[model samples]
Target: MSEITPADFALFLLASGDMQPRKRARDQQADLAGLELKRHVLDLIVSYAPPADALEATLMQIAQEIGPPYGPTRALCASIRDEFADAASTPGFMEWLIEEAVRENAGQKEKRRGKTFNQ
Candidate 1:
């Protein structure tokens, strides 16, 4: 698996919480499922490859802004930052994350397609 860069982590963090307005009921369900999956993926990443102090602080700040209900907390962010070595040590974990991300993006694109008729 390719290395997981800081930018990748940040982008995933940002994208995972994105919520679009005016979604249909089915779309909302899919969005929720996607969000949950992303969150779980984040948790896995944290568990394996904790963040550095600066990155951890940034994550905490973001999480604070994201806040309660469905959002991750500063404590949760810290927890992940403190435990990254596990991810780094695990075989195939990084590959799995990249695959999951690609799949998620493809699913999102499919969801965004408009109806069409063959001529």
Candidate 2:
């Protein structure tokens, strides 16, 4: 948990698409429970510096534009609430976030495509 940073959280949010700006917050306000762990994890990532890549920028923008303004964790909670409102809880959600961090740090994921020039 201590090892997790804000940038990592943003990356997780971005990759998971849990904080998309297009989503409506009112839709999820009803089931805003069981977000304590996510809130804790989100707090850790506040001071983290995201990578200087397109994905990071995109995530930052989404967070900034959301209703809470740079509150990716809030957006994430809302999303989870909307998607899993009926279910009490789901195990391994945090574990999946950890796996994303490991994969990111190890560069195990595929590389992003860049602009190409004709030879």
Candidate 3:
């Protein structure tokens, strides 16, 4: 099997929001790979996010806050987590994240209201 680069792994971690300020910079060397960082971060949030089940509940609450589509994704989770299932911290949270991504994309296609038509 081809080894994954630390840069790539860190990119994936950043994508998932699992990265710490120092750790991100430390992953520059292409040697420290093989570990999934995103799931690690998600687990941290799930276990330590103050109030049990905060991620799941926050997702829904933010969905309501952002007000549909855009609400849940950014308003709720901030970024989408691909491996929510393997996260082991909270189950099914990734589903909500992806579902919101789809919804948010759909919502973006609708266009915002503010353009005055030129005669």
Candidate 4:
């Protein structure tokens, strides 16, 4: 594998925001999943950026990287919909908008479930 330079790693950290760790620390195997998800998001955002001009190309890349969100990722997105909703209106925020919708539907369904007891 090609070695990653510190500058590249720094850029990744910048792109990933709060997802990747900032300092060296003991990490578990399960931690890899979150890191991977962050990287996937970063990749999509970068690819979708205006200068890149490759939304179509990045869509395929994102699909290959993330596939359809599965159990945990779907659940995570659903749980954190409020946090992501602000970004939904951004130009390249389609995927996140989808997740926001997922979370919205999930929340609406939950509310309906609660109302069913009253009715």
What TM-score does candidate 2 get on C-alpha atoms?
0.27
Compared with the true structure, what per-residue lDDT tens digits does model 1 show for residues 3-98? 565445535553431422345655476556555644754654454344443565556555655556434455555655553434457787655555
On residues 46-91, what C-alpha lDDT tens digit does candidate 4 reach at each position?
A: 5455222333344345455566655555544333333333333355
Residue-level lDDT tens digits of model 2 in 45-107: 444454323334444444554435345545664553333322213465556765765666455
Most accurate candidate by lDDT: 1
**Model 4 segments more than 4 A misplaced:** 1-17, 22-27, 49-65, 76-81, 86-119
Instruction: Tell how far residue 30 is off in model 2, in angstroms.
Output: 29
TM-score of each: 0.46, 0.27, 0.25, 0.33
TM-score of 1: 0.46
Better of 1 and 2 by lDDT: 1
Lowest lDDT 10-residue stretch of candidate 4: 1-10
- Checking candidate 2 for backbone clashes, the offending pairs are 5-45, 6-45
Error of 3 at 71 (Å): 8.6
Q: Which stretches of candidate 2 lie over 4 Å from their true place?
A: 1-77, 80-88, 108-119
Global lDDT scores for all candidate models: 0.53, 0.44, 0.39, 0.47
Candidate 1: worst-modelled 10 consecutive residues by lDDT: 13-22
Tens-digit lDDT track of model 3 for 1-119: 23322233223344432232335545554323213333433444543443433445544554454353453244224442223324334455444544555565555455442232322
Candidate 3 Cα errors over 4 Å, as ranges: 1-12, 15-52, 70-82, 89-119
| lDDT for predicted candidate 3 compared with the true structure | 0.39
True-structure RMSD, every candidate: 7.7, 12.3, 18.7, 16.5
Backbone clash tally (model 2):
2
